[model samples]
Each structure stands twice: as C-alpha cells, then as structure tokens.
Target: MRPNVRLELIRKLMQQHNNPSFMKKIIVAILFVLLIVGGGVAYYLYNKGPLDVISSHAVEISAVNLYNSFLSDSAAAGKKYAGKVLEVSGLTEDVSVNQNQETIILLRTSVEGAHINCTLEDKTKVNANKGLIHIKGICSGIGDGDPDLGLPADVYLTRCFVINK
Candidate 1:
C-alpha cells in the first residue's frame, strides 16, 4: 500500500496497544495471579516441614553400608542419598533425647563407636531397646567422626520412624 496508508495503520495499532484501560486491566490481572500463586507456595512451604520435602522413593540400605559408602566417598554418597528417605537396619547403640525433645537413636555399624545418628520424628513414640531395629528416615549427610577414639564418621538421618523393633 501507500506510505500514508501504512503510517495510519501503524498509528491505529499503537493507539490500541497503548490504551490505558487495557494496560491497567492486564497489569491488575498479572498482579492478582502472582499474589495467589505466591500465597499458595508460602502456605505450602510453611505447613510442610524440611524432612517432608524428601523424595518418597527412598534407597533402602543397611546402616553399615550407608556408613561405608560415606566413608569411602562422602561427595558421591551425598549425591546418591541426600534428600532421600532411607530404611536402615542395625543394632541400636544408644537412644537419647535432644534439647528440643526429639528422639535421637544411634545405630551401631561395623566401625567401632561410630553410629548412624537418626533423629526420630515422634518424640514420645520411640521406646528403643538395645537390639536390632529397622528405621526409616531422611538421610541428611555424614556426621563428624569421634576425634579422640579415631572412629569413622557417622551418617546423619532425620525424621526417623521405627519400622521394626
């Protein structure tokens, strides 16, 4: 078409695109959607605890194997087991409560005095006996080893629940 006709068409398109009412409505809609989504995410994260965020399809392994994997290569073990639930079975070395009233069970492994520190979910429900126990928990990482005794490092598991006594 002619230059004048093209210029007029462009002007009309610009006027429609820059309409104040339409822009206001678009901005309001975007803001409303953002608010709703943000609120939903915030509420979900607030209600769900850290341990609950772990993957449901966990890798089941013995406590000794878990410890050995970490001892062999901590970075590789962390990549494989971190943020995943683990079902570990071993002898219960010690059972104690932390300051927050959380039950912590130390599961003995092949390494002497080195134990997997499993923090149970229910504080009042754990009645640990000195025997073999099956536990399901979220493996966080490896714990520091006993410096004085030269014991190997321990695997740290959180939100643990007794699977079998």
Candidate 2:
C-alpha cells in the first residue's frame, strides 16, 4: 500500500532471509548431497566408459538384457576394449594357471557359450591352495589365447589371478 509499509515489509523479509547459520547449514547440506551424487555419477560413468559401450566389449552390460552371445563375441569385446584396462565381474569356475603361468582365469557369465576373461597383469600358479576368487585383469585381444596352444592354454587366459571379492 504505502511506501513506508512496503519498506517495513522489505526489512522483515531481509531479517528472515539473513539467517547465516541456517543458510550455511543448508549450503553445506546441499554441497554434501551434490558431492555424494557427483561422486557416484563419476564412478558410474567411469565404470561405464567408452570401452563399455555394450557393443561386444561388454559381455554383460547393466543396461541391456540379452544373452547367449557367440564365441566370437570375445573378439568383438577385445576390439572394443583393446589397450584399455576394463573390469568385468563374473563367477570363477574351472580356473587354472598353466606352466607358462599366463594365469588362465575362467569366468561364468549369463550368456550361454558366451564367457568373459579378466586378464591379469601377472601370471599366477594354478595351485589347489587358491580358492575360487573374483578376478580383475587387462583386456587383451582375442589372439592365440592360452587354450589355442594346448590344454589350459587353449583357454587363452593371460595374466590371471583370484579377485579379492
């Protein structure tokens, strides 16, 4: 209505808004939430990067739901993820390390006849002492895998090991 009344109203509003403590707490809370969400998004995006485009490289992408890929799929996976350090989690079964010590790791995936290998950086001994373990390794091109060489080697597992869960 009147100018003086409007000025009083403005002053009241300013006083209510000048809550530094509350403002600080709200800012902190907002920042905390943003940091957490940002970190999660960064992690998720990092895990699902250019390599994991779900084009053959990703044996089991969290996004899509399809199974029973062909044996050659590894080749595609390799091509997509070549020279890149990628992580693929799968059940370890029939794992073995050969004399060459390439560390042949076997992973079980949802796709039938479709398997993914997490090639480790170093060779491991196929000792009975080592129990079933989750593995992480470098992604190598589907070349003359260990298995192609012979028993165990034919599996083409290189730089293998048991993943610590």
Maximum-TM-score candidate: 1
Candidate 1 per-residue lDDT, tens place, 6-34, comes to 99999987887789987888899999999
Worst-scoring 10-residue span by lDDT in model 1: 49-58
lDDT of 2 by residue, 46-138 (tens): 888443222233232210111122244755655555554434544554455456555556555454333455445455454434343444344
Candidate 1 wrongly placed segments (more than 4 Å): 1-55, 146-151
lDDT of 2 at 68: 22
Query: TM-score of every model?
Result: 0.66, 0.37
What candidate 2 gets wrong by more than 4 Å, as runs, is 1-76, 111-114, 118-133, 143-157
For model 1, state the Cα shift of residue 158 in Å: 1.0
lDDT of each: 0.84, 0.48
The positional error of residue 59 in candidate 1, measured at the CA in angstroms, is: 1.5
